[model samples]
Target: MEKVRFGIIGVGNMGRAHAHSLLNDIKGAELAAVCDSSPERLDWAEEHLPDNVQRFLSPEELFKSGTIDAVLIATPHYDHPPLAIEALGYGLHVLIEKPAGVYTKAVQEMNDAAAKSDRKFGIMYNQRTNPLYQKLRELIKSGELGEIRRTNWIITNWYRSQSYYDSGGWRATWGGEGGGVLLNQDPHQLDLWQWTTGMMPKRVRAFCHFGKYRNIEVEDDVTAYVEYENGATGLFITTTGEAPGTNRFEITGDNGKIVIEDGKLTFFRLRTPEPQFNAEYTGGFGSPECWKCEIPVAPGDGDQHKGIMRNFTNAILHDEPLLAPGEEGIHGLTLSNAMYLSAWTDNWVDLPIDSELFHEKLMVQVQNSTFQKTPVSQKALDVSGTH
Candidate 1:
């Protein structure tokens, strides 16, 4: 195929952005069709999208319409896996949005389906295109930062107002969103955490505050601790409560340490690797010699969502590798799931968590929910400055 014909099934905030991207910025992608369950969203598409674009009120219609070669599923967190699964079944390449699914059980099933299909399957982990993160991954993977000892990420700038949650019925409720902050806002960071480091935690223990600042029924604040198989430790702290929040990621290894914050990357390079320094040094009150350097990052961010889309298109048309493979999405979702399970069970959760147990616990939250949501609008909000 010269160009990948794309159909977007959910013109919500992110979906609308994807529609615009596929329509204009992405070169090898053509916006073949658009679908949404919301009438207001369909109206917006009618006004904003080209007349040549096929519009559908239901995703199933668009999937089988034979107008699209690929489908981008941008519905709620819960619908991502099922919609992608169905799209794959219809012999269309599938691209899923973040969180993959609220639960790993469903996402695993979707991954299984993708494995059996001969079509291209990818996830919208747009941040993977950022050059800053790509550089970090290179450093770690190249062994420049030898043997990671500790990692900490404080990505808590996702402050959502009451009006934001009040705008959609499926904003923060467990029945609607499955979980908050971790599920909705922090998936990218969680994905980046494992993606950049190339390691998954051996176990995780987390403390989550449900409805701590929001009026919703799901968690809005969380602090999680994880230990890697090599005894490397990590701390992930995030929330949607604080206004003047911070986003800083620091990693320490045997060679030195690196900090990424405020759009700048800094490195403290040790004259010698810490293990060697400790082994060779005879002094009691000394540390390895360190040289601070401001590592230069490439100017401007990557095409982000557009970049991921273009990469997916290239993968389908030219045999290029995917930047964010759909199956790998499970790693980040695993971290998020471990956090929720640790909090819900009041105990530590291990890697490759018991999906059945997590699903059982999640069902209780869904079945026992009594919170009534009041949606303030059915129209899509301007998602320009937000993730």
Candidate 2:
């Protein structure tokens, strides 16, 4: 195809953003069709979209109408995988919004469909396009950081007001949107945490606070500890309960330490590891005399979402590699599920969670309806004023 004809399914905030990006930024990509169940949302999209674009109220109609060569899914988190699977079955490329899916089984099914389809399938992991994160991945890959010892990130800045959660009924409800903080807000960070380290957790144990913010039935605060296959340890902390929060990611390796925070990438080059066995042990305060340097970062200037979209189109048109392959999305979803499973069972859930077991347990939890009460910040309460 000379140009990729793109249709957007769901014209919510993210849907509109993707539509805007396709219309204005992503070259060789045309906004062919826009679909949404709500007429008001459809009208809003029509107002924003350029003339000569097709509009539909249902994805089934969009798929059958031949108005689109591919569909970009910006629907609810739960619908992402199913929609993408349907689009793939219809012989159209798909770009689904993040969190991949609300559950691991859905991710697996999506992957299965993609593998059987002839079109390209990708996830919108825009953070992977960020220069800072790209640079961190490079540093880790180059062995400049050496054998990573431990990694920690404080990503509480994902803070959401009750208003944010209350904006959509599906925002914080388990029945509506699977899980909170981890599934909705922190997927990118969680993906980044794993992607940059180039490691997958062998097992995960997490402490999740349900209904911590808003009058919802899902977790809004999560602290997960991951043990990687390489014996590396990681701590991931996030919440939707705090304002004026901070975000800092620190990676320590045998040879150096890279600290990324406030748009600064600082590297502390260790002459040697801290352990006496690895270090020369000079017995001095400075010890091995670490050197500090600022790593130069050159970030791509543009909409990251657009960049990923363009990349996806290019992969279809010119055989270019995708940034976030559709299949890899399963990894991130699996990890998220593992974290939640660990929290629910109070056990270290291993990788590749027993899908059947997890489904059974999740259904039990769903049926039991024993909800945990977590404190919501005043700001959160104000946002969810009704509850």
In the range 91-146, model 2's lDDT, one tens digit per residue, is 99998888787778878999999988889999988888888899999999999998
Q: Can you write out model 1's per-residue Cα lDDT over 68-157, one digit (the tens) per residue?
A: 999988876777787888889999999988879889999999999999999999999989998889999999999989999999999889
As a TM-score, model 2 comes out at: 0.91
C-alpha RMSD by candidate, in order = 3.1, 5.7
Residue range with the least summed lDDT across 10 consecutive positions in model 1: 376-385
By lDDT, the best candidate is 1
Residue 154 in model 1: lDDT: 96
Candidate 1 local distance difference test against the native: 0.88
